[model samples]
Target: MASAEIGVIGLGVMGANLALNIADHGFDVAVYNRTEERTREFAAGAGELSSKIIPTGSLEEFVAAIRPPRPVIIMIKAGDPVDQQIAALKPLLENNDIIIDAGNANFRDTMRRFEELKDTGLTFIGMGVSGGEEGARFGPSIMVGGTEASWNRVSDVINAISAKFNDEPCAAWLGENGAGHFVKTIHNGIEYADMQMIAEIYGIMRDGMDMKAPEMAGVFDAWNSGPLDSFLVEITSKVLATGDDKTGKPLVDVILDAAGQKGTGRWSAIESQQMAVPASAIEAAVGARSLSAMTGLRAEAEELLGRPDLGRFEVGGNAAALLEQALLAGKVAAYAQGFAVMAAASKEFGWNLPMPIIAKIWRAGCIIRSRFLDEISEAFTKTPDVANLVMTPEFSRIVKETDTALRTVVAEAVRKGLPVPALSSAVAYFDQLRRARGTANLIQAQRDFFGAHGFERIDGKGENHGPWNMGN
Candidate 1:
């Protein structure tokens, strides 16, 4: 099986798992790693496909082991090391060979590499893989970007190992050149927003209603059956139910209230700003993570910002009831933000990334997958240019009825002077859209004030760009 004869570099958590997944799919794979032992250990234990996995201690051996016109996937980190690895491997690869960089590469870098490799008679694809480590091993959402001409030469092999959504592989030769990484970059951006929104809901339960994590987790579990259901909610339920690993105490309190982020979150925020996507939730999350890394600074702030009292939520009412209701409302808000980002990305990339296709792909193959994704798929298929997620009647209704309770939750928490960025952002977005007045214009005014930048004036007659009134 030419499609199955392959080599994988970098046996870190993601690489190792993916190699094993490929082997499990009955592929002949030669696995290599910077350190020999990990590769040996993983290959040695291979069960049904034990013979299929060939562990190579030497990089040369790994290169020689593959058949001619070899297909190799570099799962290493992006940047210099990638070029370094390719330089070492290039001499070993034959003409008409293919190289797949299945890393979270910067799109521009991907484009540069594409140009560099063309003269060598080699095919290079920058593929974006989502679903993290687990996704890598089991099934993953994959996006490929390269020449359409080469896709016929390589697409079958690439798709074979990718996760399926609605029985279609979550694999597409996204478009020419840098498109793969571009899609993946935006995917991570969406993920950042989604995770932060979930984090916000948990905060509301803990600080606003004073409900516990396990209690909140249960609410998420129930929500998994509804229109708002998703993998995030399901995992949240597990997290809430889980107790402290050390002392067997409820784990929620022990977990630092702060969040952490890799660079992808920041990339999304930056890209959104560049593309003018108005990615507030993602920006807020990235900011939240930046704040998280400063643990001591946050600790010091505790003296200035005390906890909120939402005892009434838990005192008389059932915690699960309150949380489930609130989460349904919150998910709607989060998905709305995600859709908005995707819409903005479509405009930026000219991909016209069908939201229905995106939602369908996520249903089974992504971290954000859930029953709710189905509704999202339907919404987008019905209306491709959905302005915002909550604009859908179903979602709008949830926000409408639940906003009162969520607002009370937000207000009560703010009374205690706690910083709930995600929750506040969601609520603010809700109010901003529902209200006749939009503060974005106020923001434009402030920018024009300092930078002498132009602003869109909402004059009594109509909206138009009015020059900055710096003269006054």
Candidate 2:
């Protein structure tokens, strides 16, 4: 009957929840899954909201149920499946119909898809949705990338379903083509670094200080009320506090140490390298995940080199306070590197990405939502043209204040043989960043000596060759 205002394809966990969210917002949503049984089940489970949901048996029915110039959200497994779905839907959709890919797609794929849909009267939006299963059902942060007109068409519904901070929606139109996905990738990369740093601190507490799970959970809970307040921190405390019913032990202690990654963090590191920007913290986090996955190799290495017996990890004073400050410093470095990479990408791609808006939208709905992001938003709003986030006055002050604590923590971790890759990388990054004159001059001279690659002289002599005495 074409009565449904919108259509959602692929009723997986995310898709089903998003559809329910849309229906809850007073929009008649038509939904379809590959299996007809799943679609029928979803409709049946809708209960009181069943009337607002139009369950379709086939693609034809799904397309027919939505009104003209429909906005269809395809939330399925990313990559080839998305292309296949889009190909199938193209034949059924009319001109001006919108196709939104709401998945964790690589920005490159998003750009290619946008290009493929050009001049066909169909609009393509690469939307980055964050906040997990519950967030999907209640509210999520939406990052939209497409033409302004296309964003305008779906803004109302998207805004209505997004998390809010101080009565403002967390959803926003970031830019054209792949901007949303690119930003999302960086978001994940920063997430990797944040999680890795937290894990490193937990490792220090467990192995270095011999702390128990419940005690550490109390510390994390206390930190949540302070500067470190965020979703991940809250969850860490909850996870630590939880007890395994079967084993009668803290659930986290019984869990495996290995971690899994899904490529976004690696992409962030690769793209930063491509742009010649240093995102070492993100890189270190990605590397840590890779290393974690190599459980057999790690066991072999640990066997070959016995675990360090160096006793109690000692900081100068107040271990908890020092760890908190160190974590904050590392977070600053990770976020600084992430934002710097995005700034470079924005220029390279001509996205004209609004940094302040990006930060603002991230404050409520996304996985990385925090009071810290609000500070970043305000900082960017004040100094929109800053070369880097750390260069801003507010961030500069934070860096200065936390510098000593970061140094002490990294040094103590290194001394005690605790692995703190992301945290240590932050120390190195800050050291290199603050250094006015670095040792690269020697490398330049060596290059000139071996390959005749000229070096720029400090005494106004541009591109001068170094005199190398080679006794042949």
How much does each candidate deviate from the true structure in C-alpha RMSD? 3.7, 1.1
Model 2 over residues 1-472: C-alpha lDDT tens digits?
A: 6899889998999999999999999999999999999999999999888999999999999999998789999999989999999999999989999999999999999999999998888989999998989888999888899989999989999999988999999999989999999999999999999999999999999999999999999999999999999988989999989999999999998888799988899999999999999999999999999999999999998999888888789996699999999999999999999999999999998899999988988888788888899899999999999988999999999999999999999999999999999999999999999999999999998998889998987779767885586665
TM-scores for all candidates: the values are 0.85, 0.98
Q: For model 2, how big is the CA root-mean-square deviation?
A: 1.1
Candidate 2: segments with Cα more than 4 A from true spot: 469-471
Candidate 1 on 80-110: residue-level lDDT in tens? 9899988888887888777889888888788
Candidate with maximal lDDT:
2
Model 1 misplacement above 4 A:
1-4, 304-325, 350-352, 390-406, 416-418, 434-472
Instruction: Give the range of the ten consecutive residues with the poorest summed lDDT in model 1.
Output: 307-316
Cα lDDT for residue 72, candidate 2: 96
**Weakest ten-residue segment in model 2 by summed lDDT:** 463-472
Candidate 2 TM-score over all chains jointly: 0.98
Predicted structure with the largest TM-score when compared to the true one: 2
- Structure candidate 2, residue pairs in collision: none
